[model samples]
Target: MTAHAAGRYATALFELAKSSGAADAVEADLSAFRAMLDSSPELAGALASPLHAAEDKVSVLKALAEKAKFNELTLNTFGVAARNGRAGDLGKVASVYAALAAADRGVVTADVQTAAPLTKKQTEALAASLKGAFGREIEVRTDVRPELMGGLIVKVGSRMFDSSLRTKLDGMKTAMKEA
Candidate 1:
């Protein structure tokens, strides 16, 4: 599967970063680069486009990395991704890398969805609350999905804690129908 391949690449990158004492730095760069991919459709298209020559894609990636001032290790890792023609899976690679890094630090990630963006303080508070409940350091990734209408949904590993207004309304409708 693509995820399995991505996990292998991510493990290699994570091991390299760990041995070099730059795992945290590399993880941060991965997040930033993933964000860049999300924000730039043209860049994403170029990387994922089979029409573009691999060399050309590598050149464009190098130029963009230089402009962004990416560290040598981060740049090299991305170069490998492009060279292998796995550029479209870069985000998945980043996610896998983050998981590896967090596991190394004995932390877990929680995907949080809300109707609106949380402030930094709110995020910290949420993490603290989750830590108190789960007894593990929590890395929170928040997505603002307006369709939720209101409230928050937190997913950690196999467990989900959904308090979204949409779910509440749906439950109410089902109960009323049954009644």
Candidate 2:
């Protein structure tokens, strides 16, 4: 149900952004807002908590949007969501909106997690390989997961290729036990 609501909000925002030729700006705004949510737990709680009144949430969102200098479309979307009591779904809405925008542009997002940060050249190589394999332009989103120990994991859409050292070690342990 939350996803449905998020999708509806995202679709509406996407359509508006597309018509206004501000999709990229809106996407950047949402990405920055999501990063803000990640860094500020209080802000997230304020937006998501039922204890906060709708009007209060809208005001908070407005102030933050203005401070961030978000695009007009992004500010309006956030305001509407807050007023509709869907402010909590903003993160999900951003994700959905990004997917919609990428699909419209024939681009695919690859979520890559590596034990350490990838060099710029490595990132470009990986993206190129993915593009060749998928036959579509690839956008590589990378994260450093130290727990992985080594290697990398890549997820594109529903498909995941897990080649992390942690997974390999686990598999080896299982095999040794069976032996």
Candidate 3:
């Protein structure tokens, strides 16, 4: 259940879901699955533990998926992961799959961590800026981080632009120490 293995599984699942015309549904299912893992510590531990038998894991997943009404492709992917003894990385796989699906649709997700709440106009402006920079439709998720002191930190994909006062001060302090 290494990150690489999870990424491979995710890529495969994304391709399959795309071809089957259920990419959006599969992504939603995976998002729900990830949320379940986050909210249920016991279930998360069980899924990530290698001590459970494959059959037991599959049964648990089956029950959970049925209750959640996950798409067939998503359920099948989970079963395949269990059978292959890679169930431990299912969460990561789902994450990668969702990101891939978003990218396929020319959508980019921006994580905006700000010192305070942003107005609707601000959010729209930020999204527009990101769209201009990335040349794609941007989905901006806003989060308040009071520790930021002021300004915003915009993260797109693997890149982060930190304009927060806290980060700027930290950088200056580190530079002085190094000097």
The best candidate in terms of lDDT: 2
Taking all chains together, each candidate's TM-score versus the true structure is: 0.83, 0.83, 0.74
Q: After the best TM-score superposition of candidate 2, give how far the Cα of residue 56 lies from its true spot, in angstroms.
A: 2.5
- Report the lDDT tens digits of candidate 2 across residue range 1-179: 99999999999999999999999999999989988987897988889999999999989889999999999999999999998899999988988888888888899988899999999999999999999999999988887899999999999999999999999999999999999
Put down candidate 1 lDDT per residue, 108-149, tens digits, no spaces. 999899999999999999999999999999999888899999
lDDT values, one for every candidate:
0.88, 0.93, 0.88
Q: In model 2, which residue pairs have backbone atoms overlapping below 3 Å?
A: none
Residue-by-residue lDDT tens digits, candidate 3, 45-149: 898788999878888998899999999998888899888888878988977886787788788888799999999999999999889898889978676889999
Clashing pairs in 1: none
Query: Which portions of model 1 miss their true places by more than 4 Å?
Result: 166-179
Model 3: colliding residue pairs = none
Q: Predictions ranked by lDDT, top down?
A: 2, 3, 1
Cα TM-score of candidate 3: 0.74
Candidate 2: deviation at residue 131, Å?
1.0
